[model samples]
Target: MASTRTTRLDRKQVIDTALRLLNEVGLEGLTLRAIAAELNVKAPALYWHFKDKQALLDEMATEMMRRMGWPSEDQSADWREVITAAMQGLRAHLLRYRDGARVYSGTHFTDTSYAGPMETFLARLTTQGFTPAAAVRGWHTAYSYTIGYLIEEQAMTGRTFDLTARAERLADHPLAAQAGEEMFGDYDAGFDRGLRAVVEGIGATLRAPGAPGKGRGEARA
Candidate 1:
């Protein structure tokens, strides 16, 4: 039988090893045996805590969430400021590990334990005068946009193509050329702009007259 401290240390070791593997080899290359090998433990020992690879991945995702500092309770800060901080934290966390966004996007965790950040988002939206349904939609829209943007950003990590040259080529198409220039000059600024746009657009829609009910119906129309 293992001592309590030994068991605790083993669990941390497994999770730490898994995170390293995630950064080094990505989600696809991560496995129970691989993690065990990395930690010099038997594969069955890892299974003692995590039932399977999916379980391990879920644990890893949970670990990632904790690292992101998702708000546990309402902050005294402004709604937009709090929500934006959470989103930016997620973006930074995803960028920390190779293909972190891809790993996160592929998994689904619907239980309350898995939705801390989203719960915070919904609460913020509601406090800002959005109805429940509107708040939910706003949360989804923000989450989708953030995840999609991060995935694209991660995918572009190793490209050798010249974005400026591409922009010059697209000069024949005026709008495309302008977009290319925007893309080439400070990509991080572009992401921040898009994030603000989505959040502000949701706020505007929620505030519009008869929007709580009417806007949702019209949006579906």
Candidate 2:
């Protein structure tokens, strides 16, 4: 039997091995058997730590969140700044791994481990005077927007179209054609502008009197 220290090391090794495999083979290729083989361990040993493949995936997602410093200790910033920075950090982290957004989208948040960032976000929003329900809604809105935007941004990168191609395609719409060149010229700026707009809109909604209270009850931990 492995010592407790050895067991912990083995679990970390298995998870790290799985992450590397995920990066190399994409989510579809990640599996317990594959990870065990990569870690030079038996599949049964992995199962000892993870009930099944989904459990492993959940652990992987949780690990990814930890890597990004979710549940941040710093509470110095206002809600808007904190949320925006968190979203931006999420986008950057997703961009770091292939098919990262897909992985994140599929992961469940019912697990408190997976809900750390969200809990922190809602707590901040509620502190800023948002109702619990409003804070939850706002958190979901920002999260959805960030993930959706990142998906679109990643998809755009895979396209072959350049400014000239876009310009020609939009020639019938003269104004659009002119805008295409400038749009393509500074795509990063456009991304930031869109993010800023979303954050500002959410902020405005929170600031409005009677917009909505956090909701009828207290927030869940």
Candidate 3:
């Protein structure tokens, strides 16, 4: 049983405090003790609200998802448009904090409210001629792409690595310099172009007869 003092602390309050501390400390430094200190509570008190650090992380990710406006209600938009918008929103949200992608990665959501919205989103895709499996897979691919991109993006921008020194080393290599420019320049445009390519590939799978959820006869004899 939680003690009177522990019970008095709100779960939301603890999670919010952890998020604020996350920006200050990054993931490595975001311990339960740190959060408790931020809230002016004992470590045990937080245990009443969160079983462990991972549990707290799960809730933080859930809150991030909620803020990102997941399951956005763009039912009338094309499936590709829906996917692009979702990935874009996710990238933007994750970039808002230090190590945001790392924090969000691999954490289970404590909230089940997202399930209903996900079901509706999937249903909309099926209604628009996608096989349920294909719809899910396509979205997974896009989600993976977004997360992976942000991980690299955050690493590049969040760190104090000397880009100028590296550029000097590669100055003799014209192609490498140009590649660096393409990679480090205009993140927004690069993400959109990559997302477009991914969406296009997913669209191609829809017409492939052997693709998951497609009819057997749909393939060319």
lDDT agreement with native, every candidate: 0.71, 0.70, 0.79
lDDT of 2 by residue, 1-221 (tens): 64222333356677778777877877778888788767666677777788888778777776777678564655444666677777878888888776677667766542466566666677777766677887777777888987887666665665666778777888899898898755556656766777778777776675445433332232422
**Candidate 3's residue-wise lDDT over 65-153, tens digit each?**
77776645755556666777778988988989888998888999987966876787676667666888988988888989988888888
Residue-wise C-alpha lDDT for candidate 1, range 1-221, written one tens digit per residue: 53322343356678788898888887778888888767766677787788888777766777777677665575334555555676777888888988888777766542357565666677766665677898787777777888898888888777766767887888788788777657656658988898888877876775445533323224321
Candidate number that wins on TM-score, 1 or 2 = 1
Alpha carbon lDDT at 208, candidate 1: 44
TM-score of each: 0.76, 0.72, 0.83
Q: How good is model 2 by TM-score?
A: 0.72
TM-score for model 1?
Answer: 0.76
Give the Cα error of residue 110 in candidate 1, in Å: 9.3
Best by TM-score: 3
Pairs in steric clash, model 2: 131-213, 131-214, 132-214, 133-214
- Which model, 1 or 3, shows the larger TM-score? 3
Worst 10 residues of 1 by lDDT: 212-221
| Structure candidate 3, residue pairs in collision | none
